[model samples]
Target: MARDRKPVKSKGGRPSREQAAEINGRILSAATTLFLKRGVDGTSLEAIAAAAQIGKPTLYARYPDKSALFAAVIRAQVDAAMPPITGVAETATPAARLRQVGRAVIEGAMKPVPLGLMRLYIAEAPRHGALIREVDRLGRQAALEAIAGALAGAGGADAIDRAHVVAAHFLDMVFVPHQMRALLGDVPDEADPLHPTLDARIETAIAAFKTMHLLPAE
Candidate 1:
């Protein structure tokens, strides 16, 4: 019988790509849980390392400080929540695709983890304005990219040029209002007959956009 060969490790004893990804996921997950439970000011790098079952040196090696780690966490969250450029079906009309994009934005914002982080961010904004802006830029950039992709079928350079303007209007008209209500603890309740659910809000916004000629033609 042939002898079983031992698995070869990466050069210089470094972790493999899969291992590195797993370690990063664990670290982010631990940090997110702890931060949500205790707030960013109350959480420490050492605690995060312990919760992740990794050494402090490893955590420090990846992130020099708590702020750096927090930013990484935010980036991961935003990346997960934001839809990719190819998320919408190409067969759909530009207006219908835009509606899908809007729905994605609202649903992503209302997810448990992102919602928790939003509350924490608002509470910590005064003291951590720079850090907040950094992550806020990450999310806004992703949102704009997704919005622009949805508008790509509208026209030529004009459509691309006006993408930023359209993105701003879309967020202001569809997203910001609902996000404010959510931030203020006004969540949708199916049992409550008066509650304005996200889908209903999206439909209303899409109709309004059509009436205002804001949405592009198929």
Candidate 2:
């Protein structure tokens, strides 16, 4: 018979706040890696716990189920990829701000890590429609709010509905085509690579948005 194993005692008091934060970070880091590799549905809490070097009870303490854990991961990824916009001066040119915000959005979304997260999110979307919808809602709200503000300023006397329409057009010009190309795969070697460099794409998108919305309206 195997020798009787000694029982491990809990640390008695709960982990210190700092220690708990570190553990949570560890969990998120592990989950990000696995989710990137295997996608949301493919990954399990047991795998996440193993990857984080934590026990099942510990993982359960923080995240009771896969959707809860995934929601946490998705929120983190969404925030990281498309962080909330703040601090533009009230009088700043809306077009200039649109360029700035548009670039940030594209760059964040196109990074290798976030790009992988997006693919994973799409892969898991068929099953988790509501979860994906929530993420989309958050992203759209941030993007549209800023873009619409910019358009509102640019439009001056333009109606709010028209300003919003123009804002949607701006996003379509800047984000849709390039994002779709990237998501689909790669362009032909002979073809332009979706705007040469990231900054160029951003600049071109801003120019396109202006041509489509501003100059035409003038």
How close to the true structure is residue 22 of candidate 1, measured as C-alpha lDDT?
A: 79
TM-score of each: 0.82, 0.72
What lDDT does candidate 2 reach at residue 36? 90
lDDT of 2 by residue, 111-138 (tens): 8887787778788898888998999788
Worst 10 residues of 1 by lDDT: 1-10
Off by over 4 Å in 1: 1-9, 85-87, 189-195, 216-218
Model 1 steric clash pairs: none
Encode model 1's per-residue lDDT on 1-218: one tens digit a residue: 11212234579677788777777888999999999999988998888988888888778889999988888887788888774555577678766777778787777888888889888887878978987888888887888777876766555787776666667777876687778788888877766644577777677666776676766544
